[model samples]
Target: MSSRIIAAAVAVAAGLALAVGGAATLVSLARPDRGIDLQNAPAGNGVDGGVVDYGTK
Candidate 1:
């Protein structure tokens, strides 16, 4: 293939890769499986039915 075609293919691949990566990252970040994010929400219930501190003391 020509250099221009190859470069265009590479640019398209890179854009697609970046788009997919960004989507995956957003999905992963949107999950609510945190292990006690209690700093901002200190009054919430905890593992043992108590309050938890996320090291903000």
Candidate 2:
């Protein structure tokens, strides 16, 4: 029926939208806005300076 065809088209469109949105979100999260200036920046405890270090149990 026509109604069934319309419903199927809507579902496919919605799925494509969600897939594009998810891809955009992951791409955004993968890149940094500002570049890190490690050479100019002072080092205190390296990358994990304040982070707690778990020694051998």
Candidate 3:
């Protein structure tokens, strides 16, 4: 086959791969099942008392 034909085939394959990947990402984002409760996330100053302890300094 000619170089032009091979190049076109490669471009088409790459485009299809990108399209499939983007579609999958969108679908997964649309329907999350991790059960994580982001709205009720723990506060930084809650029982943990923040992530850093400045008293050591």
- Output the number of the TM-score-best candidate: 1
lDDT of 2 by residue, 1-57 (tens): 999999999999999999999999999998855456455554466564565458758
TM-score, model 3 to reference: 0.47
Question: Which stretches of candidate 1 lie above 4 Å from their native place?
Answer: 36-57
Model 1 Cα lDDT, one tens digit per residue, 1-57:
699999999999999999999999999999875666654464545544775478885
Residue-wise C-alpha lDDT for candidate 3, range 1-57, written one tens digit per residue: 699999999999999999999999999888845566676676765467656456774
TM-score of each: 0.52, 0.50, 0.47
Q: Where does candidate 2 clash, by residue pair?
A: none
For candidate 1, the lDDT comes to 0.82
**Segments of candidate 3 deviating more than 4 angstroms:** 36-57
Local error of candidate 3 at 36, Å?
A: 6.6
